[model samples]
Target chain A: MCAQKRAKSDVGEGSPARADLDRTRAVLEGPEIGRALTRIAHEVLERTKGGEGVTLLGIPTRGVPLARRLAERIERVEDRSVPWGSLDITMYRDDLRLAPARALGRTDIPAEGIDDRVVVLVDDVLFSGRTVRAALDALNDLGRPRAVQLATLVDRGHRQLPIRADYVGKNLPTSLRESVTVLLDEFDSRDAVLVGPAKARPAPEEEH
Target chain B: MRHLLSAGDLSRDEAILVLDTAKELAQVSGRSVKKYPTLRGRTVVNLFYEDSTRTRTSFELAAKRLSADVINFSAKGSSVSKGESLKDTALTLQAMGADGVVIRHSASGAAHRLAGWVDGAVLNAGDGTHEHPTQALLDVFTMRERLGHLEGLRVAIVGDILHSRVARSNVLLLHTLGAEVTLVAPPTLLPVSVHTWPCAVSYELDEVLPKSDVVMMLRVQAERMKDAFFPTAREYSRRYGLDRERFARMQRDAIVMHPGPMVRGMEISAEVADSPRSTVTEQVTNGLSVRMAVLYLLLGGSESGIGNQEGQA
Candidate 1:
């Protein structure tokens, strides 16, 4: 998502005011995000038949907290905790040589592991689908899962791979020139989804 | 960042970055499939002109764990034994499109010379008595893991300081990381330029033991010593060796470290080397992680790709 990229760029520069933020529109706010996650939690339980043998694996940066939130929501309803952990896909990326080497993120597997379990790969945004592809490759090295499903807070159109999210918080359609930013209180001090003109040049393929 | 030639080459931030990156890469070794696809299709050539078991194998395993195709080219039975020039051998590797070259040579500055002749990144495994940056890195990694930090930590490096590339590199790196280093050795074994280094020198190991947070014992290179540097090996062990008496003088939480192939009885006691405080084996495991970090940083970037693009322009 653009939020992850934005946070990375903000490291060198003290949070500069971008002109694009002025033209952006907020598609989802804090309360809306909470409700959407709750609905997704219920949907996951229904699909997996009471969420048995389920493990939530969040892709790093923003996806980790998203996965934790989903697990908590599931615990509230089912009176049982679902195993959750973070899976960093930086090593499995196809576009590694395209840019400078990235600092690796943490990958923590729960004690139960992912073997023979349904792994729900969670992320903030569904864009070019390359990150999901990398996640799938990374998961292969971790353990064998019975089935792997995709979950995202926002499912923007124009997926480059033949992948779709099984559980999507919002279906927001936009042009390729627009950037979708997901801000979570766990990272950015607020919860909001914004659609705006590309911050830099128009990114043909938005990196997740 | 391009080549790991010396410990002094890394800034404080750059050094910390490498250590942090190694911390993440260390997790891969514990996974069910202990290989990452980060360096797939890339070739890392281990060109060793010196005989080594631990360092050469560590570099090879590190490269393989990153999924890089590795070619081990030791001097034994290789073209180098037939009098092939270093330049010519480097050129051959360059022509073969090596993405990275890990070199351990008998002559100092061999890795630097190879860097000038090759397009690939050059990693100095151990270049004569010059510097072994990765070994120093693994030492710091092990220390940081045990001590939780390097800032303001007191480290006393004991034994042979003159012929040790590990001692040279560790002094430079530990100083850069804000650790106070004290070199404890006989005046004959200490280098003439010891004062120029950013560390204090001590002749009595016993006096420095209690104040130190880490005591690193350097191997007395018996093979490299042509003349007698000391009265006798037994005399050196009695005066400077980390025996039980000196070990008890150290802080309760102080760690004992030796970059391997140790002259156990001469430099460190057998009991101390096997003690819970000894990080010798942990250093070997950390070496693999540190080398992986170096290779990933040097090859994972788009610098090589950009160089090719510039050539076209």
Candidate 2:
């Protein structure tokens, strides 16, 4: 979904037209997404022993708001605020040279820092797992965490790297030609997971 | 975006994009690991035909921070001293598979000429009296950092306008960024074509200081002057120099800037240069960020994908 927007701009005026929205189907609605995130927040608490020494770092674009939402849920349940920030992985991507230079996103590490703390990386969708790979490289530069775990709202399985998410909201089996898009109310008008025909050429390596 | 040959090459949006990119790249420097793997395998050659301390080091450091393999080539000790032509030197760098070439030459438009010879991106460090785009970029970055925005900010560039590449680049870039620029210099030091530029001209520094938000003092290039552009040093200092008395005439929040290697008593007073209003030191640090943005914007992408992707929101 994100790749199409970039591909459209890359090709400029002569680019292939956008995929038909009417042909797409919503896999997860707003309520379903909320419930999944609530469950993931509880699972994070369970795994980290009531969320002690844990920091949530979101990958940019869609991942940021998802991390904030998870932090809010964790705060409501535990009656305490959780440290959360956005981590941009544009500088660490392997395919940077394949495409044009990307505009850098914000990387706001919490005041407490991530050193010796359990870092949970949250993203909207996990596909080829390359974005996670890039995020891990970006995390190494910031500070040494005690351990790093991956969490995503949706896991549309097409793993390129030997990576697996620790906390997944939905386990979706998708074809290579299909595009999985996770839209939130923060960025887009609606909050739903849509499945549609691949727009532009399929950038299988793009995991966002 | 392929090569930053001149500040004039940048439009309003393009200039803003570079500044914005520099703002994000600035955060990387504060990290424990002050490097990015973006240009891991790329090669950047720092080809210097002229002598420099800040600009050469700044470009080298910026390339290194991005993890690009850097090759520093200075003309003093190199084959250029043995009568090797610029084309021959460029061909050698081309053979080395350079992805980017940062050039500082004594000849004006040297970077533009090098761009024609090499397949890699050519960055103008400073041409003879043409332009120092990166210096202007860092200056603008420093202004935006301190003043919050560039739009409608009053900038007064004072000193040797005829010989200063910094002045030319700053005038072009600051104007593009929507700042109101006024060049303050003596009649002899002012360029003949200064009236044609997109800026106001002022003869008295004292008259412009009170209305200025940024007072950029250019170094009086004594080496470049064959004849007398001004009278004695003391006489020029009394008239055009930015002393403590002249500095006092500036607005309360106004800043005094000098692109480095500043002549202490000639152009800017020592007290004002060391004062809180001075951004001399900050300009050096900001130079690294601005150069990184230029390098990343030039070499971070494919050759064909240059202009299409930089304006991303």
Candidate 3:
């Protein structure tokens, strides 16, 4: 995933980059990330019965590249093309009022609507499952899919919702203070997954 | 980017970001599914103190396309009709948890005023003669669509400048995007401080036409005219209106634009308005995508999440 620029002024206590440098550590490097995706692709094919009528919808940012890579793998194995698109869940998130306003990303749905087709949502990391819940709500508005499944590079277990990924590259149990950051070649010009302590920052009003 | 009250508030990068986002969102319109779930649970209020069809509808549609729940509060039907103050109305929207307020008011700087009163993001639809930032964005979006770029391109804004919020906003925004703007209007219609703006002033429309890559025609507000800005409608048409003759003189690739509600004979002839070079219709369509982009950026999407992070920080 591309490194989202967290504003320096907005970082509550210490320098965000400095804090990242000190506390964050890589859990999976480039080669490991590639292997995980390959295994997930095979699992997806096995689950969906050779990937027929399956459409890959990547959640924006890292998920998009992950979805594309999965589709490429599915094509090479199954020998059939799988349609892919990007799903932006900004509007459907439940915590919109609780959090600051976010920028909307592109929602590029394939020309063939999701109706009666299997949809596999791809993402870099599955944390909290809030994004998945929002993605489900977003997908419902587009069309009724035959089945909706999720494939993630990492599942840092602390799901606040009743959502689970059918295909998980790694299941890393993490605490509330820890965050899993994903890096993809398509965005960060490298592939890796990092686990770091998420500092308890002050609330927006409390910040300078 | 938080509160788009004026075109002057935008830097070149911020303006380009909106345009780029609009370009990406424009693709959604062609898809099998026209809606996106970016703002599904968010509330967007369209608060209009002035009567406007195009802008209000465009914003409403833009919000709807992004799956935002829109509540259109017009002055004639709303509590404002009962003399409720802007502050009271803002407080009410705040109480109801509106995530964004797209406001159009008759008074200049009304949106800016509303911004200070509301906690949610405030988008200025058109605040009197001060600015209509989205309209300018859409115009720039259309210009870039036609010409492929705005840098160093010549744009002639023709007709009323004094009472035109469109002209004012366009000058500010186009200038920021690296385009050279020339305001072509009768001296009486030009603002007194026109020289202070980052543009050239021109009295001859014909001279500016051949050199301009884009010609934007402003709507002459007949109702707002208390004094004679021009001798007669016929005289204005003959002198400043973009008729077939002037249209022919423009570069063959030159695009004609009008922030609509056009007085066909007074500011633009029917022939030219309907001509192939005119982007009046496209502007309306582009308005939806442009508004969508602004709302998306301000509200926070994953790709452009830079907006809301500041709120928490």
Candidate 4:
């Protein structure tokens, strides 16, 4: 009976999907993901003069793979390695208590650090711009980069903050009722971007 | 959901999540910058009702390392020593807008009672002999770090189980994580409710030592001993103390562990305590990361930053 109680709590009473998002359409596919990352890699190299002092800090989960893929492409083009690491903005986020608690993701800044370097922050989807704000806050604590730029696979517009991506792969406008989902091989074992209408969020229980 | 009052309060998944989060955050310490902006703009008050330099300092460091504002409140001075009640003290902290409270109290279940008075997260640093949830989390974190896993591991806890909130928390947590536990101590030192705990009891330390993967030596609380739990400290050392010879008899890869503030000769010898297999110091270092994980989870702001990357619409 105690084990049963533990089992229930193990998964957590907190709902993972607070809002039920219904799948509508698949926007980007596996091959398209590969092509988009390659293109972003070239754009990153061109903007910063052949990847000199360039560092790619993925915003974890999908962003990590996107960063790595870009690094590989940049390395091939520039004939030099690009310093890469992961920056987890879980703690820096603004909407922490507004949603169910999320587990912390990996924050690995390279040993040499992001100081005096052109650091490119990579993420899968760009939405409310709050995540980018949190990422900026997280980067400030690490070390001041020479210049910090944002890159994303999709920029589904309705940004709450005045933040905008530096190198956006696709500028797909999204509605308030829809959610953008980015599935990466590193996490979901597949590469695809899907847009869908959000199902009604369960009404939170009323306090007595 | 808002408080960590006991080890049993964490489900298997929550426990693992804390450990996993600690594992990720542990990398932060390795970096030259050794800081994360996770808890910035947050206030964490270490309201220690008991005298504890290590636990309080560890929590303070954890909060600061995460870039959170920390206030170290000790019961030694201030209104607490002026006969002010715990409720009033808590209310004062609440009024100050404490985002989280890391409390250590002399009374059992003080953390639980404090949870009722505060809207912020309450963490039981060590509440009498009831539970030290973070300590247990760190112990298991150290165990998992050394053993690479906790499943099916043999852990023999020695010395003062009766007065140990660490032992109580460890037994519950380790059992939940599928580790077999055996409490090796004098029958007198064992609690009256020991039989109900999810662990085995053994008076023969030598017999249990050979089969154990982790031998945890708890501090013999001389202050708490009203009656003679054993004949003498010398006799207790000869029979149960982890001397070099006794340590040699265990599995070669077997590690020695203590929860700190260890009595050098009474429960564990200096040789065994300082040996390569000992994780006493690692337990302290791991304590910082484990406490950071707890504070992050409870006051970590949003639960939306984990596993699944996609947030709500």
Candidate 5:
């Protein structure tokens, strides 16, 4: 809790730490996440057949939010709570050196190891396949799983890695020179992915 | 629909078309019915791996106004809390049937990954310290709204250019429209090779203040302080903050701009932010219009009807 507090501001109105928030927003007043979750939860139920032995592991931050929603949906649908856990794979990343050293998000292991359990990895974007690989390694450290599945909202194509998404809300075939971004109402008070031309940002030291 | 991914994907003509289209979308916002039947029966999902409100709201409102069903999936409280992978979460959204998605992630290319996996249109809100195209578009829209044209306007982008995606996109868009861009920040806050850009560079905001027709300020993230990005926030504020003194030093008619939630006592002063000369609110208002334009054109509307070669639609 103390560590999380250090990385993220204590939530409140008009906090000085709000400066850390890059953009201002009317976040809580904007829209709903529950409906989307309920819809996703229904999809997961359809795929897994009543959520009898399904497990959901949300990636830290936003992934956890979606996982909780799906879990609630699963519980509501099947009258059973499949195991839910929040995993933080910051230490497991391959490109940690590319940027600043970040404060770790957190990793909570389910009491049950994923061995033989249908494990679904959840994160906000399916880029590079590196985070999923890191999650796999972290999951290996935790326990064996029966199967691992993937899900995302948008698929902006141009993969450097061979990874593919199984379930996608939208398929956006794009160029290597383009970028697709998703913004949510919780962290971001608006909900829409934007497509724009990619402009290479020179590293700071590369400025004219 | 395709991803509104990068400026490189667009020719100069395509870029102006988006601006021109946004002008038409602006009309829709003022209507008694802000809703359009253009994107009816379509589902737009916002999937932010990063934290943002302004860009998200712009896209959300844009989609809603277009009559598309909107779904928001933030990475803060659900499966993200339990460590579900990005691939998994994306697949979940796909199964749920999302037609288009707007994404914002801290990693520079997280949006690229999402674009590859899903079967819908993708839009890049922002990815890391990379690019915020709509912010740049709305900013330029605000400028053009006031100045009548972007050609030959002397625009100065001040403050932390090093970590500003807004600066990157603005430089590209502004230069594309024939504006003379001067990036002002400390030596520590600039990119390594700025001359490659069609813009000028300066270490002092005051030196260039008088000549600039438009002055855009970027937020200074104190978190960058963890890496010694600058000596002190006080030193930075002293050097770069658009306080009453420095703001007074600017061209009298020149407007001040920020992609806000401003840090009250930090990068910009309350007086300047609240001043009649400030275009911040206008930027927000224009963001929805700019985003609506993006959704419209990229969603398959004719570009010729939206904007000309340079916003003379």
Candidate 6:
């Protein structure tokens, strides 16, 4: 995992990294994401013995689609629906000012209401672990879960917080100056994970 | 320091404490960071089902000032308008792991239902005409900032008390803060069981203006406004509006306040709202401070239970 420049701010909005989101979208839909999420679903089912009372929670934006796909795959294999909900974890980030301001998304839980259920947190990629830590804090405000597990489509690990995805689809290692971008078909036309230079750059004056 | 669901929830002492804290927070609003990080990483969601630019935006800014990550959720053009139930929407917030939910809804008791639905702290930003706790809190904060004390003070809240959540919240909260509140509205515009409230009733704003230490004008909500509440807007303004003549009746020290999005010449003339004695603009400024005080004390600073925790230090 990339560990260089830990203080690097997010490449957001007008940042060039945002422009390259299209490239990441192509990678997501192109057989690779389909293969990865399917593998993760299979592993989750094998570990949980067909996900009895397990709730699949997707962190907002990217995580939501991944969670939906995992739930569909789990249902097809098990012949029963696994409860699914979407979470907006924007509030939980430790470094809020590091990224551009964003509107909060929807976090929708199933009717069963989280109590006594095994919750599996879904995210696109596992980077600094700060997102998951924030998710933990956010989960506390929800009802008590019997147990909570973490799942990630990409484990490009650079652990800032003491967090680890319980279920991992694939692990890729890279330098700190690199970035991992995940795109899905629902919001993006293609599915892909791209390894690229950090999109954040200095002002135009420092271009030389 | 708990969720401010209603102004009535705060006792006189609690109200004073919040105002005092707000004064201190106002001093640092222009700093480079312009943030305290007091609620660092704490999630505050603006789950608004009703359309509101002023209230929603103000609450969002308030949360941001305290260093809370604010998520603005507008129901318009979303799945919510497409028949997605409130339960579904609330579950979404729960899954997102929101820390605090500040909600505004057209339907009364929407906040109550949301409280039962989410495990997070629920604050009623504005729940129909049932109550608007923060608005009332800010109004009180404005009053305390200008008047110094609330006890034995005469506060006249004029206009559509029947359809105003702000009026309902203010009346209850002001009385709790030891102020004598008089509700001046047309008899037809008063609530059916208005006498159950802590404040006295008056059909005439002019008759009550002389005795008032504070004059608070409530907006005549244009959308839900039913006719015959008064003959016409002009007549209502003539009777209840704080125009120059009405303003002259108020004590020289009496401050005027409005929750805002004011209809310049309708409820109050522009001159009265812009007057030196008016606390209308100050109400907006005080809103952030009061909200900051609420978020900090509820989520942090548990060390100060009440009354002089500083002396021990």
Per-candidate Cα lDDT values, in order, are: 0.86, 0.87, 0.81, 0.81, 0.69, 0.74
Compared with the true structure, what per-residue lDDT tens digits does model 6 show for residues A51-77? 888899998666777899999999887
Stretches off by above 4 angstroms in model 2 are A1-19, B304-313
Candidate number with the higher lDDT (2 or 4) = 2
Backbone N/Cα/C clashes per model = 0, 0, 12, 6, 108, 20
Q: Across residues A121-169, which tens digit of lDDT does each residue of candidate 3 receive?
A: 9987776787888889878877899999999888877667788999999
DockQ of 3: 0.23
Higher-TM-score candidate of 2 and 5:
2
Per-candidate TM-scores read 0.95, 0.95, 0.83, 0.88, 0.57, 0.58
* lDDT per residue (tens digit) for residues A115-189 in model 5: 788887766555556666677766765667788876655555545556776555556566545444445555546
Q: What is candidate 1's CAPRI-style docking category based on DockQ?
A: medium
Q: Kindly give the stretch of ten consecutive residues in candidate 2 chain B with the minimal lDDT sum.
A: B304-313
- Candidate 1's DockQ is 0.56
Candidate 4: CAPRI quality band: acceptable
Q: How does model 5 score by TM-score?
A: 0.57
* Tens digits of per-residue lDDT for model 2, B1-313: 3778899888777787788889989997789999998888899999999999999999999999999999999999999999999999999998989988899998998988888888788888999999999999999999999999999999999999999999999999999989999999999999899999999999988889899999999889988889988779999999999998888888999999999899999998899999998999999999999999889988887652222222122
Candidate 1 residue-wise lDDT, B1-313, digit = tens: 2677888888887788789889989998778899998999999999999899999999999999999999999999999999999999999999999988999998989987887888778888999988999999999999999999999999999988999999999999999999999999999999899899999999998899999999999989888888889998899999999999889888999999999888778889899999999999999999999988889988986752111111111
Q: What does the lDDT read for residue B161 in candidate 5?
A: 88
- Which consecutive 10 residues in model 5 chain B have the weakest lDDT in total? B304-313
DockQ of each: 0.56, 0.57, 0.23, 0.36, 0.01, 0.01
Q: Write the per-residue lDDT of candidate 5 for residues B181-261, one digit (tens) a residue.
A: 999999988888777877899998789888999999888865544577778788888888899998888888899999887
Residue A175 deviation, candidate 2, in Å? 1.5
State candidate 6's DockQ.
Answer: 0.01
